[model samples]
Target: MPMKGLIWFRTDLRLDDNPALLDAIDKCDEVAGIYIFSENQWNDHNESNVKLSFLIKNLEILEKSLSNLNIPLITLNTNSFKSLPKDLNNFSVTNNINQVFWNNEFGINESKRDDLSAQILNNSNIHVSRFDDQVIYEPGILRTGQGKPFSVFTPFKRRWIENFDMNFLEIRKPSALKKSISLNNESSKIQYSKIHKVDIDLWPAGEDAAAARLSNFLELKSRDYNQSRNSPILDGTSRISPYLALGILSPRRCILEGMKLNNFELTSGNKGICKWIDEIVWREFYRNIMHSFPKVSLNKPFQDYTDSIKWRHCDNELKAFYEGRTGFPIVDAGIRQMLTEGWMHNRLRMVVAMFFTKNMLHDWRLGEEFFMKNLIDGDFSSNNGGWQWSASTGTDAAPYFRIFNPITQSQNFDPNGDFIKKFIPELKDVSLKNIHQPKQDLFSSSDYPAPMLDLKTSRLRAIEAFKTAREFNNS
Candidate 1:
């Protein structure tokens, strides 16, 4: 009798180049895979509808692929991180399995779950194996001369690129069907999604779809990415974030696709594509940061100095902003887009995040939590890193003094107001010049609320608050 194994699928959904999956196939004569819904994890983490819906759809596609490979997916409805081990063990013993395998996730609770699962499985002497698949490099892949994690991005990026090569990014494809062991195909023991995910019309699931999105972005839009990425109206960005977030697409494959578009002669054309690749590296940077400072996932700001800085509990104002009646066209547009589309452009994410955390004098965590609740592409590291960057509360943040003026950001980024017009129909009648500052008009939209607070006044107040906090610390 050969050793049968179980592969627990978490965020790494793609079949290509997964180190854990490859290694599992190599060592086990038979392998079965499962994906647990973990409802509490999603609720506690504030995962948005778009993300939730997208994940379910992706899992369905994943289930089909696994079925084709002779490994039927077992959908576990368990919610608690502590509940995983016993649930997995019960299945393993019933199925006569010997080992459990999975790719490791590094978030605070995710790590806890992995730890508890490993221990419980060990008690039963079921060998558990995990691997790194999501990131091209692990947490300490690039470090300073002192072996400390790089706090700043420029030097970190330089070191990251220097160490990056194609081989390290490679993942093995799905094993051939002939190699799979026979399974009980007739019995419908597991629960399958009866209703199609409602919002899935917006995003297609499956590995093939992820590949197509990558190909389309690299070939058609990537060269113009530098110029268009900031323009909210243009298809400047890859729009593959949902795929990336759900792990339907691999970052390794993303980098390879980017390299295909690279010219390396000048950065504007082919160079622009390389610059877009920098965004992927930025995602890697946050992951590395989170890994280095486990406290980040524990609700501690990357920069602890922001702790003494008092954050206002402006629930009414926060409610107004979240409802997309912020009176700043760009900010409102971004929020409205989020409500309708479940996604926001990368540049607009920065602008709205800064405005909420700085101009509104609200806590960055509040805004970060809101983003996670609303964004389809929300992931812990990226969302937290983005909000902190905008709020000037991060490890490598925008200088507190260099705050983004909402009106100027709108005019500069959504110059034509097409993105604004798409989300905010009340501003539809407003001209481009005044569109970004529609609140400057005598309360234009009866449907939309006026500016919750004045920008300049709030800006000064936030700066003073930070200065006062820092001043007391120095004293």
Candidate 2:
């Protein structure tokens, strides 16, 4: 009789170099995998339907992959972790499982779920093991000499590069979970009779899809990524973020491919390709931030003082901003792109975030939640960090006085009405310079909406708010 274990899969959907999966296979005998769809958690976090669609598609792909080893993926339809312990315990006992294993997640409800599950398993006399697979280095692993989390990205990124070793990326083949176990081991398959209707046109899932995307990015567009990642008018981006967000592609695999290209001492693409890896490292950084200050995922700002700042309420203008009727071509373009495609360019994310929080004098949290509702690539930490950074209310956020001029940003990045025209159809007939500020000349009134509010006036209002806060705090 082999020592049986239950491998509970969470964010880490792939088998390649997954820390928890590897650990369980190393220590346990027959390993049975379970992926539970917790609607309770998704509702609490406001996850988009696109996200669920991706999960189901990836889970299906994972099932096919698991079938290769004759292992069955048992999906459990549970509402919440409050009763998961009792539920999982009964199932494990019936299946004759001896251990439970899973990876760590750093969200509020996620932590609760893991804690409740662990406590339940502990009482049942079953050993439980969990691993940190999401981020390359845990939060505390890399800290300043005074034993504190660094707010700035520069010093942290430098240390990350210095500390990373080549051996970490070596392909790891995990121990087999009882080599001959078949899908027939489970008495029956868990069913989710009432799942949301999912259309996966936006984000495709699986390890193979992830790998192919990486190959396409590296082969075709990587050379120009450094220059073209910012331009919405051009599609020269490495759009592997959705896959990376879902863990269909492991960071180690991405780093290995980048390193292989970067080590090409003679190629010019190496430098830009390596720079792309730094963006991947930024994801790790934000994940670690959430890990250290779990309250962030609980909807708290990184800076405590920011909580006291009174954000303006301009429901009418904010609506204009979100609907792409702001009359600023660049800002409007980003907003429309998000509404239509459920994703925006990384550069545009920064710009539109700034326009809303800084120029419109609106709350960053509102924009953050809106993005979560719409963005296909929206992760809690990254989106929160992004919105906060733009609003000057987060760790390493821009200075309160420094605000992005929407017109200037459009002229600099878009230069033409190409990206703006794609989303804001009314601006299709407007000229390049007029498109940047269609409301100024009243040129696009026939089809497009007018400017919600003057930019300079809004910018001054934002400044005044910050100045008042500064004076009050000083007093």
Predicted model with the maximum lDDT: 1
Q: Estimate, for each residue in 325-389, the C-alpha lDDT of model 1 and write its tens digit.
A: 87777898888888887788888899999988888888888899988988778889999999888
lDDT for each residue of candidate 2 in 330-426, tens digit (9 for 90 to 100): 8878987887777888878999999888777788889998888776676887888888898888878999899999888888888887888887776
Provide the TM-score for each candidate, comma-separated. Answer: 0.93, 0.92
Error of 2 at 264 (Å): 7.9
lDDT of each: 0.79, 0.76
Model 2 accuracy (lDDT, Cα): 0.76
For model 1 the local lDDT of residue 264 reads 34
Clashing pairs in 2: none
The lDDT of model 1 is 0.79
